[model samples]
Target: MEAVLYVLHGSRVKLACEQAISFIETCMEEIPVAIQEYCFLELADPTIEEAYARCVERGAATIIVIPVLLLTAVHAKEDIPNELARVSKQFPNVEMRYSRPIGVHGNMVEILMERLSETGKLIDKDSMVLLIGRGSSDPDVKRDLTTIAGFLKERAGIGRVDTCYLTAAKPGLEEALEIVKQSKYKKIYVVPYLLFTGILMNTIQKTIRKSLADQDKEFILCQYLGYHPLINSVLRQRVIEAGGGQDLVSRHA
Candidate 1:
């Protein structure tokens, strides 16, 4: 069987890792290929190099390196490519393809919509919706956030979606929350634009609780976008694109 190697940005807990595993595994249904392994960029076992070694050992001729990243930051543009070059040298017989980060895809908005509605509260069209991203120094990474926010706006019925950052960028969650509160809207939803639960998500939630308790602002902090099936669909597209399979652009569209 063929193999696909998922290159995830690692996390601290086994649950998050398991989420990544399940995310990719669900995507694997379309391919008659085998899942060689799932590896991490850091903070967990089975790093990318190790996954490549296993793929090479298994005589896999093609491997797809899907970065389970929200944005194409330094990790995807610089680190992943450099590592892929090294992996290529080690496994000359196997060709590897690196895919765009998960953020660039459109299915994410569907997940975001589902996540937003998960609160059982329809986003007030007149209110402000702050879409918080795990910001990055990379321009490409930042651009993806803007694109997603704008897409949500175009979709409508979710209110005016505004962009903000959790870290490493401007207009932090606090600032966005302040903007929304000052506006006529009484309710503000701070949507965490993360793939899984982690330190950042934890910090955001705590900060929200404390801020509300202190200022007595009315805000609802929803959970991070847990391993959604739409994400699984996006991952499959990336894997298929990297695997040199049929055109998947329309599928992603």
Candidate 2:
């Protein structure tokens, strides 16, 4: 039977990894294809090679391998490609394809805009709005966050929106938060650029919450982006539309 392998980027939190898989499972319920799944690279278990091998062993002549990542960061581009190349060498006959990560799509724009709109309703236009991302060392990842923030700023009609990272590189969240505070705005909002729930999110929220105690109680901490109902259909259409090599595996969550 034909099989589609939705490969997750292993998470530090076991629950995060499991959540990613669960998101995909819900998406695949309607697709007629036989679905197989795996998580390799980073944390957790089952390396990509093992998953590819398993698919080949199961008589899957064509395996669609989707890398369930948010953006085209180093791990998504370098690590996944290197592993796929190695796997391709072993199973020369199994047609496999890799699509770009789901980033900056119209639907993603919708998600951000929706969040900002809802938040904007709670605050006055004079209040400075800050779009906080988890931040990544990868420049491309950072660019994605900035671009998304820019889009939301225009849609929400907010005068200002700034991007900040959590760790790695410079300009961490504290620096960004402080800058906004100096503006002496009545309130500030921080949005998580993350897809899954995990320790990084918890830590960031705690830091923000603690800092907010000194400020006006109106400080806003928006929720992390997750598997919303429309997201499953958005991911499905993304893979279906952004096609590459024949038999190339495309996965989304």
1-253 per-residue lDDT for model 1 (tens digits): 3567778888897788888877766766654465457789888878889988898788777677778788778988889889889778977777777788786667888777777678887566555567888887777766888888888777656556778888788788788776776677657777888877878887888777766755544677777877787777777777677766654333333
Question: Which pairs of residues have clashing backbones in candidate 2?
Answer: 64-249, 65-249, 66-251, 96-248, 97-248, 97-249
* Best candidate (score: lDDT): 1
TM-score of each: 0.89, 0.86
User: Which residue window of length 10 is worst by lDDT in model 2?
Assistant: 244-253
- Native-referenced Cα lDDT, model 2: 0.71
Cα displacement (Å) at residue 127, model 1 = 2.5
The segments of candidate 2 whose C-alpha lies over 4 angstroms from its true place after superposition are 116-121, 242-253
RMSD of 2: 3.6
Residue 68 CA error for candidate 2 (Å)? Answer: 1.6
For candidate 1, the 10 contiguous residues with the lowest summed lDDT are 244-253
| lDDT of candidate 2 over 20-131, digit per residue (tens) | 7788788777444564656567787778878788888888876766677767688778888898898789888777767667777667767766665676456566655666
- Candidates in order: C-alpha RMSD to true structure: 3.3, 3.6
| Residue 94 in model 2: lDDT | 78
